[model samples]
Every structure is written in C-alpha cells, then in structure tokens.
Target: MKLNTIAALMALAGICSVGVAAELAEDPEAIRLRIGTGDPVAGKAKSESELCQGCHGEEGVSNVVGVPNLAAQFAPYLIKQLSDFRTQSRRHRIMNAMAEGLSETDLPDIAAYFASRSRPKEDGAGGPDANAKDLFLYGDVERNLDACASCHESDARGRVSRGVAYPALAGQQSGYLRVQLLNWKAGIRNNSPQGVMNRVASQLTEAEISELANYLSGL
Candidate 1:
C-alpha cells in the first residue's frame, strides 16, 4: 500500500510538470486551431439562436441539478470542451448534438458570451463534510494527491489568461463532476490538461470522489 501511494504521488508530480509544460508550449497558432478569437457580441447572438438559454439559463446559470452553470467559466476552457464534444473526445449525448450543430466560428463567440457573465449566486446543496473539505483544500500527500485548490483556486473559480485555462468548479453541478471523475479514472476521458485529472482521479477512491464532488458542487 505504501509503495502504491508513493508511485501515485510520483505520477501526479510528473503529470503536473507535463501540464505546466503544455501550458507554456501552447502557441497562438495552436490556440487558433483549438478556439478562435471570441467576440462577446457574436456569442450572445449565437447563444440565443442556438437555444442555449433553454437549459443553461439566459445568463449561463443552470437551475437543473446536473447541468453545469457556465457563467464566468473561462472562455478557452469552454471552447476546448465544445471542441472535445464536437470531435467526440468527450461524449455526452446532449452536448454532442449541441456541439455538432455549432460552426467552428460559433465556438469562440458562445464561449465568450458565457465567460463574460457572472456566476449565478447559489449556495452548495448540502451540509459540508470536513473530510471532503480537507481533501479539496489540502490533498493527501501520503497518497500523492494535490489539493484541488492548487490549480482550481481557493474559490474554485478557475483561471484563464495568457493562453492558459482551467475549468471553474464553483457552483458547478456535482453530478457532472462525479461523472467526469469516473470517466477520467476509467480512461474514458483523457483531454484534461496534460492528463493531470486522469492521474488525480486514479488516486482517488470512489468514496473520496463522491465526497469531493459533493463538496465542490456547493462551493
């Protein structure tokens, strides 16, 4: 067990290093290929026309239990996710259909519109768990897991600037987080920054994943 823990930690460290390198190595051309320059105006028009309002809400907040709130999400992150859905790198029946209908030019604009909005004011759904809180704020070094806040920010708002993007977890759907974590652990999702999430999820037990997801959804 100790050896497994050590190996997991080492693996996580390597993933972090690779992720940072990938961030730094990303170039303008790469960015253009992944997500073109976003125009908020164009995005708003597309959002309305695309019927994003029906589910994501008029301002990008989702009242549905499992639908993520997109307001204030990083534009680059949003674009990347949309791209993933389009290419089937990530798979969700609803999201795949929505992404397939989106033109390449529409990706950036829609992302921009959502990114321009503020996250809707909503409290987390349940009472806090000290164990989960501790894990999210301070990962178990013994197991080689990094704190969620190390990359996600203490508030879980995520970060995006200078060609780097991290997805915001604050006020996001717990169910969605749970599903994605499971996918990462199962190797069904490999599109995370430098496969860091794959490594992170692999180190987490099923109960730990549940605790983390529940804690994050209410943030």
Candidate 2:
C-alpha cells in the first residue's frame, strides 16, 4: 500500500475504536447544507488559491495515482465529502487539515468548480475477471444480487434524490474505489448519515469489489 493509503487505514482503524458518533464531532464552522447553490467561478478561485491543483491537478483532473479525479463528480457528493473530511467523519490526515481550514461557504464553490470540469478518460479497458463482470452487469438473480446499473445507471452517471445520494463512478481511480469499498465493508468508513452504502458494500466480497472497481474505473 502507498504511504497515504496506509496512513488513512490506520487513522480509520483508530477512529473505529473510538465509536462513530464520538469520532465525527460536528464542526461549528461547517457550511450549511445547500441543496443546489454552488458557484463555479468562486470555486475556481478557491481551487487556485487553496492549492487544490497541487494534488487534484489543474481543473480537478487529478494525475496523482491515489488521489481521486474530481472532475464531473456529482456536486452533492462532492459537498458531502468535503463536509465529511472537514468534520472528521472521514479520516485522512492531509484532507482533514485542508478541510478544517475551509469555510462552509467554500464547500459549494469547490464542488461547483470541480463539477464544471470535464471528466478524464480512462487509461484502458477495465477487463476485470469474467465472473466479476458478469456479476456486476447481470447480478445473481438466485442470490438476489441487483445489477449495479440499476442505481448508478448503465453509464454510471449516478442518481440524486432529496433523501438518498448516489455518486458518479465513471472514470474514478480503480485503486481508490477498491479501497473505499473495502473500508465500507469493514465498517471503517461509516460516517454517513444514511446507511444504504454500508449495507450495499457489506453484501459484496473482496473479489466482487476488485472486479467492480476495475470495471467502474474504465466507465
């Protein structure tokens, strides 16, 4: 594992021992939840001044190996991620410090800034294990496994609802997605107010996760 990944895992394990509610202390400075009010122009300024380009690359395209590509990610999902990182609900040393310093008002701008960018193309085809592809695309009817396309859409464009939030998976870093799925399964990334992802992730095996991550990365 990469150094940052190791650090994130260790931090997550530590937080897990402390209990979820206790670990996720509410931030007094966190931005209020605005349903749809992000500003791409302001977000662009924030990204430049805040040094987001250093890690996420120019326009959030992210060339860094482990870092996620933020371009074209769902705005609500981005907002929640920033909020979670800032509030200590999601544990990452670098992200935590960066988020802690941001105003709640900055969240929407950052989300909008990144969302306005075009999505990066995948480097190659996913070419995951045959069985895994079958499971992700077709699912196991006998076992009641639902196709991932059902919720994420066939192209992984994602769906949004007032109560439930689904994130786009297209062109995401496979390694990042794989680790996230594993974390969700292990109950180490459970700061979400809703439990849908935790439940869904818990149902998947390690192999299934690898396969899905590989597939989604190429979407």
Candidate 3:
C-alpha cells in the first residue's frame, strides 16, 4: 500500500511538471480550442436577465457555500464546467437545473461575463498551518504525495496551460474546497486532469482535507 501510494505521487509529480516554468504563457492552440470569441456584453445582459446574480453575485463572487466564485476564472474553464453540468457529467442539483435549460449559444456569453469580472478582494486572513504549508510546498515524499504547488503554484492561483484543469484555490470558500476534496477522495468527482485529484486526494485523511481547505481559503 505504501509503495503504491509513492508510485502514484511520483507519477503525478511528473505530470504536474509539464511546462511548469511556462504554464502561464498563452498557447495559441489552447485559446482557439478552449474559447472561441465570446461577447462579454451579451453575456452580461444574459446573466442579468437569467437571475444569475442571485447566487453568483453581480460581480461573480458567490457568497453561498459550495457555490464557487467565478470572477477572473479562465473563461474556457467556466464554459467547460457549465457544459458539464448541462450534460450531467458534473452534477450539482442547482447547477444542473440552471445549466440544462441554457441554449448552446448562451454558454459562451455567460462564461465571458463572469470571466470579465474582477475577483473580490481577499481578506488577507493569514497563512497556512505548518502541516498544511508543508503539504502545499513539499508533499509528503514518504507517502508518495506530490506537492500542491507542482500545479497550483505557491500562491495557489492554478495553472491554465496544456489542458490542465487546476482551479485557483486562493481565497476560495473553505467549505467548497473541503467538499470538493472529499468528493475527489470518495470518487464522487472525477473531472480533474488525468484524474490527478482522485489519486492525490485518496491519500489524504479527512483532517488533512480540512487543514488544507482552511489554509487555501486564506490565500
């Protein structure tokens, strides 16, 4: 069991290192493949009329637990998520209901509007616990765990290149992070890149999940 865990961590560390130094540099192919030209103006209008602001704030910062803040998220990521909810590939009772009825044309606009919004200012809460910080900066090699910074970066802002599906963790709701981590652990969520989260999270205890969530929320 220990060997298997180490092997998984070693494999993931390799996967996450692809273009680590250049992860933020835009790839033209990625742009074309992920997001076509979207009309932010139309998206704004559509979002307002659709009552999207009720849950996701007018500016895209969501106050609701388990609801993610969409502001400043990569447009294509948001588009993919909405489409996934529509197709039931990623299920959320509320999101499925909201997404299922949207027309194919409605997706791009809505994603664009949220992407155009700036993220809400962070509270500057503080730092991570020692254990959490170690996990984030340097994974437990004995357990074969890869560092979170391998993909999400030290600031927890995430990587967007090479079809990587990492999400920005900084200032994200702690409850949301905790639930998602639990989902990954339990196999309830399976949408991440190369199923990396599934493997990485399976190694974490529930207490570690909570500790990581609390640390990331303050970033």
Candidate 4:
C-alpha cells in the first residue's frame, strides 16, 4: 500500500472509538518464552526464516520510504516493537499481520540479527533554525516544552530509561523523524499509552515541527 494511504489508515484507526481490547490482552510470556534472551546468532536464523529481509532490507537497513531502518536499533527496542506488533498493542494492519505468526522464540533471533548488523550512515540533508536549536537544547518551560536532551541526550544518542521506551534518534533521517512526529500528532502512531508524545506534538507549530526535524536530521 502507498505510504500516504497507510498513514491515513493509521490515523483513522487512532480516531475510531473502538477500544483496543484485543491488543491489550497480548501474551507477554509468549514472546519471553520464545526469545529467552538468547544469542544474536539464533536471532539471525529467525529473521531469515520469517522473511524479515523482504521489508526490513537484507540487513535491516530498509530503503523503503515508510519502513524504518532497523540496523543499529537497540535490541530491546526491536524486541518490544515486535512483541507489541504481535499482541496488537501497537496497531498496524500490515505489521500485525506480519508479526502474528511469530512465536516468542522468533523475536530474540530477529532482534539479535538486526542488532548484530552495522547501522548504515544516515544521509541527513537539512539545517536547523537557531530557534529550533534553542528549543532542543533548552526547552521553553513556560510553554511546557521539555528539553530533548532529558531523554534523547544532548547528542541525541538514545539512552535507555527504566519503564520508558526511548528510541535512538541520532543518525536517523530527518524526514523519517518528521513523518513520525506528524504521525504522533495525528494519532497515527500511538506508541505512548499515556499520550505524552501526542500532547507534545499537539503543542508544536508547523514551523517548529519543521525546524526540529531539520535540526535532528543534521545531528
């Protein structure tokens, strides 16, 4: 499906008042039982068997417009996303379908496989506005904007936090990050159950959003 179409569908899904009851019941143990925190070698075999290469690229460096580059993504993040996809906690028709068949054992192998591969150099092509840089470094507390450095770090190198999912943003394409931000604003990507990102994105103006994307891309 076209990326725009997928985005629109996700938006609709988010706004549809349908309670995601099915997704909430996802079996965490199923994934745990399968993955078992095993070695990356086993993860590689699972990735191959699951045809992850088809969309995620041969080594998880996806070239597709909407699909993210998984190469160099933290293993825990990958595992969480996989588990969410499988359980319907994260709702994406295509991803849900893809993840549905995976056993718990499959996730570790996939996570390890992508983690073991080298992260490709990002082709970031953008410049940041001075105001955007200021916002990133020192948030406008009066406006209730939090500093990006608090979670993503001053360098934007992701750091893990307990009970929170912090994804690496450094070296990621700016356009991709912008798209994701827009998705969060539009409620298309509901990764945060507590709606932190939704609230944050809602407060940002179009220009600020553009500037932030540009700034992160150049980082």
Question: For every model shown, what is its TM-score relative to the native structure?
Answer: 0.77, 0.77, 0.77, 0.74
Off by over 4 Å in 1: 1-37, 124-127
Q: How high is the CA lDDT of each candidate model?
A: 0.73, 0.69, 0.71, 0.64
Candidate 2 lDDT tens digits, 42-160: 67778788888799986577778889888767667888888899888999999999988889889887776676555655698476567766766677788677777666667776666
Residue pairs with clashing backbones, model 1: 43-109, 124-218
Off by over 4 Å in 4: 1-38
TM-score of structure candidate 3: 0.77
Kindly indicate the candidate among 2 and 4 with the higher TM-score: 2
Give the alpha carbon lDDT tens digit for every residue of 78-110 in model 4.
778888898887788898998999887777667
RMSD of each: 13.5, 14.0, 12.0, 14.0
What TM-score, to 2 decimals, does candidate 2 have? 0.77
lDDT of 2: 0.69
**lDDT score at residue 182, model 2, on the 0-100 scale:** 92
Error of 1 at 142 (Å): 0.6
Instruction: Determine which window of 10 residues in candidate 3 has minimal summed lDDT.
Output: 15-24
Off by over 4 Å in 3: 1-36, 121-126
Output the worst ten-in-a-row residue range by lDDT, candidate 2: 26-35
lDDT of 3 at 150: 92
Tell me the TM-score of model 1: 0.77
Instruction: Give every collision pair in model 2.
Output: 31-104
What lDDT tens digits, residue by residue, belong to model 3 across residues 74-188? 6667878888898898888988999988888788878766654544434654364999989988999999999999988787866566765556677777778899999999999
Name the candidate that leads on TM-score: 3
